[model samples]
Target: MSTKLNRIDLNLLVYLDALLRERNVTQAAHQLNLSQPAMSNGLRRLRDLFDDPLLVRTSDGMTPTERALELEPQVREVLMNIEQAVQPRSAFAPEQAQRVFRIMASDYAESTLLPAVLGKLRVQAPGLTLDIMTPSDVSFLDVERGKVDMVINRFDSMPQSFHQIHLWNDSFSCLLSPENPVLADFTLENYLQAKHIWVSKTGMGVGVGVDPDDVQRLGWVDSALARLGKKR
Candidate 1:
């Protein structure tokens, strides 16, 4: 296997992976940012190297051959392992590094955590740039494709493939105007009677003390409320 690998250009494996995923010459070319002719040449080289028509044209689109299907997972794993193995091992010199950091975060994180992160980056990595994006439904896909470097979110569940850290603990608190009547006579009845506002981007009804519906959307807040036998 090592001898055979020695004869192959490692980049072809990357191209092959992209081709198998896309199953279209043009789409694979776009993925690798190569010209159509260049991608065709790569496909030709791959066919010569493997002695297989890895992809066959079908009415719907390009279809992978049985050999290509069998090789997909192995090729992806090999490329991923190689990527990790070759990644920088030396201490990161944020002060000297010139790179762009892409982050996917929520609006709440944008208002809270991003300012602090930007402050630190200004001092530590003057040359570094940040591209902070509001997360979408496909944000995890972006992370998987390497378009997003990190995501700051409060998820109910996370994929096992990701590395995560708990940044801080937070609790929800109700804020009322100082002059509000509730301030003078704050009681459970007053709290229950008071009109409330829920700020949600998705227009979902807000939970009073802890919204059970938010358990899947808002991380641990609901669990904390459950511990106290409270529901809003």
Candidate 2:
């Protein structure tokens, strides 16, 4: 018989499971700590709802009907699933746990920062594993959907939806040979006058993404230069 989900009493499934397992009203009531009459009432409701005898009297004992036999295992499985669903989760014990954590980070973060974090995890969470992916390989959509556990990188801007923390302050340092003439007078004027190569991607991918030509997506140095009425 067709049944509307909202019309069904889910608790009846528990009563039905106990009834089918016990195969006798008195025994089923004992199993559930209910009176014999209460179990009998439950049986009446089950019979009415399913429109089946569900059980029958036989000389040997109470026997399950063909329909009841078919339902027995299915009912048992459903009860087991419900039991698990309601069970409270145990607190994490990292020393006794094994799990994989996924991380998405930029190349700069991967090289400069992640090594220390990995070193500590190796000692404290010996069974824990990390799956590292670069920013260029993954989109913010992956992070929003929880496919990536964490992201560690510099950002010119981030979505208000993303929970952010300030890790540390960083700045651009010029790497030049000792003989380089720029080092003679390393003032803002000398630095800007010298030819330079700008290499930064933190501002390239904003949220889901943006066009590479979008000057509004410029990185820290370029943005700072723009504020000072200059271009990098």
Candidate 3:
């Protein structure tokens, strides 16, 4: 492996990381601002170097092979270490910088917070690009692996290694149909009697349980239910 690394160009590792993350040559090219043909040539070279088809085209999309998956962490770590070694500690000039920031956030944050962020970026960092993705179970992993630059979500406990700040305190509001008869007298009994639909992050299942890590995510609903001596 060391001998193979000695023969390979370091830039190929950057291309490989992008390809693995995007799983599409065109998208990866766009991310790196390289032409599609150039990206294709890079992929071909990477295959020859690795002696494996790192990514395979399928009906769904480009899928990473087992070898590619295994290399992901090491590749990301190498790139991150290199970046940290060379990055200046002085104030960043956002206006002059051409960079992409990847953030994983909840649907609510996407709708509410990201618009404000975009507005600020348009004025302060015209050359910067923002890639916003919906948070999944693997979001924290993404952050830890340097695949995502930031994550916006409520958590019971923040990861010790991460730098964290309280962004804002959010509150929930109940919405009801105007013509509903219960609107006149909204009480705990009426609330309990009303059928509820919950959007679960984990997806639909017969009797699947929620992960303990997800408890803080249900805080608003849980607090209301706790007041009524009930649990969801």
Q: lDDT of model 3 at residue 10?
A: 90
lDDT of 3 by residue, 1-232 (tens): 7986688799999999999888899999999999999999999999998899999989999989999987887887789889988988888898898999988888887888889889998999999998888766445657756778988887767666677988888787777788877787888778767766666767742245654335445556765576677754
Which residue pairs of candidate 3 clash? none
Pick the winner on lDDT between candidates 1 and 2.
1
Candidate number that wins on TM-score, 1 or 3: 1
Residue 19 deviation, candidate 2, in Å? 38
For all predictions, the C-alpha RMSD in Å is 6.1, 17.2, 7.2
Which candidate's TM-score is highest? 1
**Model 1, span 120-201: residue lDDT tens:** 9899888999888876644564565556789987887776667899987776788888988998888866875676665666
Flag the better candidate by lDDT, 1 or 3. 3
TM-score of 1: 0.62
Q: Which residue runs does candidate 1 get wrong by more than 4 Å?
A: 1-13, 16-24, 30-78, 176-195, 202-232
State the lDDT at 129 in candidate 3. 95
- Whole-model lDDT per candidate: 0.79, 0.77, 0.81
TM-score on alpha carbons, each prediction = 0.62, 0.53, 0.55
lDDT of 2 by residue, 33-107 (tens): 999998888888889989999988999788889998778757766776788799888877777779888999878
Judged by whole-model lDDT over C-alpha atoms, candidate 2 comes out at 0.77
Model 2 misses residue 1 by how many Å?
32
